[model samples]
Target: MKALRISAMALLGALLALTSFFVGMGVGVRQVPVPKAIPAATPTPVPTPETGVDFSVFWEAWGILEREFYGEIPPAEERMYSAIRGVISSLGDPYTSFLDPKQASVARQDITGSFEGIGAIVDMKEGKLVIVEVIEGQPAEKAGLKSGDIILKVDDKPIENMTLLEAVLLIRGPKGTPVKLTVYREGLEEPFEVTIIRQRIEIPTLSYKMLDGKIAYIKLREFNEIASEKLKEALRELIPQKPVGIILDLRGNPGGLLSVAVEVASQFVDKSPILIERTKSGQEKLFKAVPGGLATDPSIPLVVLVNGASASASEIVAGAIRDHGRGILLGEKTFGKGSVQQPFTLKDGSELRVTTARWFTPSGTAIHGKGLTPDIEVKAGEGEKDVQLEKAVEYILGLRREGKSDVCEGCGKQP
Candidate 1:
């Protein structure tokens, strides 16, 4: 089954399944346009409960505004959009949101990973806009945009009350245009401004190299459609060298398609349940690993690296590897985001992304709002080298020296 899994920023935080593109770093597959508008179905009115509550007041206000409002009132369709936004906002779910026709069109481009923007992933946290990931070789990275920088303004406009999508709209523009951003960084008393030239960004999926001449180190930037295939190709090239172990780095990865996550986990796990999905009605569905994975051999020692930015599909893969004892998890706690969202197109060509279910690890641990904790907690210092990666490499080399095969008791065991 093709499950729709997403995080916050389509290319950044949450996942939008339309084109399965990366948000923050700007990577993904081909784009697919939103479906054509369908005819509106007849409404089936429900009888009001006997609780004595009346919704007639809403209609009365609408009628009064239509009759006596001084300024030019918006079209009925435009007003309907506001009404829908109000209703969805009442749910108090940041993930469940409405995208208007224009926004919906941009979302399609976002998931496909090609757009005119600074190429940085960002999200709203506690009313503040925060950078999640900066795409390598992109304008954001070239401008020295770093993860964790809190955005204070866009184009000199205060972003205090703007939604993440609002700020995104302001930040992105025609290619070669400049967008100015003011951000607050830790240890700095005052905020600073940075001008970035927007350009067409194409995000790369994975990067790998052999470490210590024996261990294969693969860094998965995002879980896009081609992630698993790229990983398989990387393994094909690395396995011939007979590496002692493998380190899968998932730091700063937001999330993407659910099906892609399953494919990624299958590469490391053999014939085991990867994750379980629980719907609102309490129906449970199991996602198991498929046969013929590139790295399913239990004898190969494995390690996974994660951080606060690793979420959704990334968490699924990390949680499976840890729960099945196939590898060791090392890094900071993951970004807790476990809910699933499905998109429903409206008659106006807009879209509604609604949260429908929650996902659990193989051991039945709920990941929604509660991120996974790594077995070995390693922190990376600010402006310092990647200490966590170095630690993973050290651990894997030690296992190789000990002549260990399959799994190490201190790290993980074979399933």
Candidate 2:
């Protein structure tokens, strides 16, 4: 079986679409590079079984088009690439996609979290480009872009029939330049226009502060490369303060590297299985927690905050903590994105990102298309304060008062 690998530089809904892979490690804002001409290589013949249908019709059509078509015939290599894409599309799995050389390069930039754009995460839902999140302190947030805003147009051009990558390319531009967007918000009767100047966005992974009640508040924005290290630093600083509880905020975080997910979960879950991976061949692999975690002390109460936008690596960590009785999950159901994607680089520098496996919580709950439900489901009303965070704080304080640090066994069991 192929090894499961996550994109090293995936963005969370900041580039094209708000799907798990798109936000976690697939989309980015860098301009696609020009395709370079390469030396032709020998074609590998397709092997057909004795009972398989003949593929002569396809070749016949290609031959006829080359000989008699009036229009300029595309190169055979280009046509082959299109055929490969069509084959992948037949799988009906959006996460399994073919990226041209240019697209692959752009994807690499996405996970790096340094690009020139409005810095808003977006997703394609019901044929519309919807905003999933706005990176805080970025141009999109400063310009008042909010989640659930449907993008109708870019720069006065309607985005009809355009793919997420195409829309992303149009929205991203050089720094200090303005990109106009028309969006339809949930409460508004009509679509409105917002012009935002693009800038180089460098997304911060994590932040921590001591709250009023001696509770440490740590907001993890993404499960990128620096996430684990930053978390360790935060624990080093705040744990010494002897905080009674810890509130981990994973709301609106799209996921990134899978290894980073395990590292993040290890911080709270002591020597236990953080995640389980089941491949196509029915082989199960366990990702166990490493020792010497900074926050593995079971006496420290932990509360994790999640929402509809929390996905992939976010769900992994949340589910692990909840399963191990390490923390209580608060807020809404997570964005169910449990499949693993591994990118295979083709000879021509393009990539085929294929789904290789599905991950489950230690308690054996599958999270694909069905997200993790929170222990305390606190829904936030429109224009309302963060009732979820407040509830987490309240729960932590109550636990402190009761002299309880861990949730009871079998609490918030998987349905």
Candidate 3:
């Protein structure tokens, strides 16, 4: 019942829908920050009287497979891990998932915002692993990987039936290792292979620049550990420039740490209870804005950009901004992913990521599967004209002259 470390709505962003384990939501097709400091609790066996479920049938099937199956058996650990996955999957919740030690390690490192993999964001579309977004200047782009490229195989092995985690494991390797990807381009009739040398990718948590109108343009890519730190750095550099307004872009952000989300929201929303966490039992908790915020000034005027993929911690920040009227929520409705995940590490270092709670905006609107609606909806896609951004800029420039707009009914309400 305690506040979870990974996210109140974090790790389930990417992997649950088969798009989560890429090494690039800050890094990986992402979800869930593994709270490393959490001591691994020893596994407790459920008493037969507690559940009253038959266990003999599982053993009987295992014995049959071991005795009569023609193929060699995997290690007992693999079988056990697979069973754990089955147990979690039976819950019928995509966010509730299990990761082996290696996958768990990758997820933990994702919080640090760097990992060893071909840099790209991938999604499972129609049962095929497709390359959605490749990190620029990284191995994926360097190897001529393009968006919409369908990956058929990794290192000559077809990725058929492999989970996103499994496929990501194949694509990820130690730095300097080579990974061969058989790709099927939309225009190309034949599937071709591209060998990429995996390297240490420093996922950019954010990038900020002073726009032409002297506005601060900050694009947040993830809520990794260093996100707030990087934002502080950006503020120190940009605030002095005296920008007319700020544009905090959260498009394509897949979410990360829950604590980091609160910290990021604190930068703009100078109010208590930046977010709310509600367990299934209807118990509620609050995450308040912390002190020492660098951008809590009400006159600065803010606008946030979000799209369908803006999830978890992304929705947290966007929701806070809208609830407090700290910014105009522009772009389409956000990726509705307001559920919190608690990562439980086992003795063998595997992790069980369970959906433990649901989170809401400061105003108490649920975000899970029902994304935040934009105050001003503008649709835009990647590589196209950024009409949303242009609209945001125009709106902010107008706000500077007209003063605070009643963008939200709860605008400036200390609710």
Candidate 4:
């Protein structure tokens, strides 16, 4: 059918792209420019009923199979499904996936608040499964899995030629089940195996406390599916304390869902736009602050916390506040991952995550590989609070006093 042909063509295009990537035959990072816009995904078309000689060509091989096959003939449905799978596998984008009924159900469960697994965000780096971010308090983190860790094997299965998703399926399983991961650490000369028992992991979204009883300290862990809800709950509890200022921490938060980030930013901005999603056709979708969204007043002094690991949606929120002059950023440089990844499902229930567009700040500054510079830079230290947080608190309180006697002299800056 025409629709089937078109679908196959599109799928072929994707396959060609991925094949080039794997062959190391594609353009380099600098040569392959980031998408300036987001292209809308094409709608899948319906196959048409075959007729006449065309119909004969369609099942020519199937008819031969039934007539000449020595063993019991296979069902037509199974053959059809196999063809569909073959087409999907040709695409080569592991994140772009197709899920059958069973796999789809498992994927839904995995996206829920908790799942049994070694908590880690994985990506294909140099043809190997690389840990992007290990969830805090999870098995991987507790087992000393760090960002950029290279996983060479799981049990006896070497990860060579396997995609990131394939590695994930091999590693994650029922709670209390054991898995051995062979990894190559940066400073270690030998590859070591870490045996870990999988457990149900509930990702923590927000961590908060009152710093010096006045500055509300909030560290947003990540913008997962439920992050915005958790953020509102955290703020509801903290706002009543009447803190002089708030430190919105986004250090090491490898961003989750974009919607979660938009919702979280809405809480602090009332009458201004938060971000704009620009599509390939130059269509811009503006995410604006909801009416009366005074969850935090603009007049209330504010400081944003960021570091090397703050990326994607974290950068979005930080860039929004910094560009709008809603708050001062305080920390070292951030992880510059400003592209948006849109997940596509393939026929085999795997996912193809493709970077669709480069995100820009409100002021039109690109944050890709060029993170936000802090208004006040602070180097972190052991046995002391993060120097960034300390500076933000001191800055807010000092500004409140406006040149009165210093309250905390050890902070270097006046008060």
Candidate 5:
């Protein structure tokens, strides 16, 4: 019996040796197959009364968890997270996501002027990992990352099939961490590699310049900490010039920090409701502009410039001004992103950025996907002088010549 056992062990050892020899010669191990592209399908809209769930998978997952998990398993909230991910994945919209606490916290910090990263806004456009916007003073901006740069790889990993959020997760890391980005730029001959050190980026929220002598052009990049204060500083410096009009540009801006947006919007609107939140329980919360919140020269004719990139807080400010008849919106339609995201922190130091509520303009117009249209439609191409701003200035000057006052006729206020 001992001899038979010895013989079996010897045979197994021989087999292992033979397998190792063949593997060293590159003959035994199977090569990993390259992944093929899966075309994106159009998302079927989930019906209203939005539990926003797929019950079959949810039940199956729950059953599996209840049966297989060791110890006490997890709480209901954790189970719901798995269910929510399954539901959101079913929608097939890569951009629309259900972030758990960890992911939510990260996303919130990304917007809140915290966290260290390459500092590029990326989104899945036509199934490609594309750069939406590069934050000024970020490592990406310093590396000459452009607005339409397609990200092909992170470090050495091919990101062709990865979603934007996933790519961001892979790219973002601790401060001073190095990341190599392989990007395909439009005018570049070949794909290039950029090695960047991650750092905290304070997104530029306000850009100002004296335009054509009589107009101050302030391009709001995004709503962030001290955005209102910065804007006020710009106004303070510009008002002395006694500009005929103020052109507030919101082109190519993805909104951020709702409170800042509200403060900025209040600078244009008088004592009136700027936005209203409609909750799931049919409750409405009104965000009204406080009295004496307008700029010192609120009656100084104003024009807001918007385009396809203008979204969220940008829409809030634009919508408020338009609804209040306080300013004329002059660019193309704004990027209508009106839903509010709430960030929940997780034990793993991650976050979930969940869309909690939808917001509407004072006139009850929801600007989610269907963006705000300009009062004076002015089409302008890239690297071109925004004709919208020009038209707005023309309109304001025309009104001034016609002896029409700058006050809101509908609101009967000075702003």
Candidate 6:
């Protein structure tokens, strides 16, 4: 991993999936988007006696556990929360789950783009906590954390069986304080230790660099609240340079707010019905791009880089670009997460993200389990070289186009 020493101001952050790596839902994908397009779904009505369900069995078990348990009983609140999680889990939809107040707070703060903690994104894979993305020049990179490194311990404490939120809280601390991570890298003989000093980290919505030939390359991390404002700032600076082409990198982005998705995409696409949404009741709505976009000229060269991790809001942007024929997508297949989530604040300051609808491309393709197929399918391996990016540069520079279809056919969708 290339070490980056970030100079931007930091915050006290306990990095989760999208915010907290950030949250696991619209509350952050890696949507970490609240509603910018569709209205938030109304909270589910409380269970009424008319509903045919038995609570006697649940009460009986609870009573028995309280009376005859072998060990000390958990607090009533924890037990109630666990029951709620169990009920939610029974629905079998991974995206629809509950978060307690603390997790909810982290999810909300992530959109602000400022936080404190080691600057890294992590997720659970096969029950192991693994580092996914390390921000350039962040404490995690400075302390030598790498993508795919498995975190076995934090502060010498085993993280086994802890939830993602629990682990993140344990790893996070006050700024300038040190948190020790015991990591197991692939080629290492034994787990090693790395100590990272926490800082106030303000995660950038996007970072841009001008490539050779004045091609503007932007790497967008998430569609947080400040995303549009930041992108406008970046575009204002880059567009004045009259760049020949643009490359948008959304490789590991997990997605954020849906409204923000449309807003960010508006910069590139000017047409209506950038996306479609379908509720379980069959009602449908077509979302259009808002007015006053920064870069709506389709003639400008553009390529979006996506991988399996590019999901939700990111997918919405990529799909819109393809369906509108505004740009071509490069790299691997995207993470197919087309369902729409609505955030409902519970009474306890906790949050519940429930899947309310499924979204589609303007062309009417529903990418739930099946991701969008890139126009140029190029896969890369871990190394010093980025083959997909190189290919994009070649495409923009007119270097390689021998019998390949770079343009989308019959893809323009009208509302």
Best by lDDT: 2
Displacement of residue 204 (Cα, Å) in model 6 is: 2.1
Which regions of candidate 5 are displaced past 4 Å?
Answer: 1-84, 90-105, 135-138, 160-163, 187-190, 296-298, 346-350, 384-415
N/CA/C clash count, model 2: 12
The list of candidate 3 runs beyond 4 A from truth reads: 1-47, 381-384, 403-415
Supply every candidate's count of residue pairs whose N, Cα or C atoms clash at under 3 angstroms.
15, 12, 13, 14, 10, 35
- Per-residue error (Å), model 2, residue 251: 1.0
Query: Which residue runs does candidate 4 get wrong by more than 4 Å?
Result: 1-111, 120-137, 141-149, 160-163, 341-358, 379-385, 403-415
The full ranking of all candidates by lDDT, starting with the best, is: 2, 1, 3, 6, 5, 4
How well does each candidate superpose onto the true structure, as a TM-score? 0.87, 0.87, 0.87, 0.67, 0.71, 0.85
Candidate 5 clashes between residue pairs 3 or more apart in a chain or in different chains: 100-352, 101-351, 101-352, 102-350, 102-351, 103-351, 104-351, 104-352, 104-353, 105-351
- Which regions in candidate 2 have their CA more than 4 angstroms from the true location? 1-13, 16-56, 66-78, 156-166
User: Please, what are the lDDT tens digits per residue for candidate 5 over residues 210-259?
Assistant: 87647778987655455678888888798788877778887765665566
- Each candidate: what lDDT? 0.73, 0.73, 0.72, 0.58, 0.60, 0.71
lDDT of 3 by residue, 1-415 (tens): 2224332111111221222433322111123445554563334333366577566667778889999999889987799788878887778776677888887777666676677778877755556777766777888888898877888998789986555666677777788888888999988879899888888877766899999889899998777778889999999999999888999998777777778888899888888888888889999988888798888787788889988767778888888887887777888887677777777777677877677788888888877767888878898855767899999999888877777642556443222
lDDT of 1 at 318: 89
For model 2, residues 1-415, the per-residue Cα lDDT tens digits are 2223432112322472223323343211112233344455433244357636456667777789899999898888789878978898799876787778866666555555466778877666666777777777888888888888888999999986555555666777678999999989989889999999988877776888999899999998766557788899999999999999999998877677677788888889885788888899999988889777888888998989988878788888899999888888889998888877776767778877777788889989998889898888899766757788788888889988898885855564765
Candidate 1 per-residue lDDT over residues 263-294, each given as its tens digit: 88889998568888888999998887877788
Candidate 6 lDDT by residue in tens digits, 50-82: 765566667778889999999999998789878
lDDT (0-100) at residue 185 of candidate 3? 96
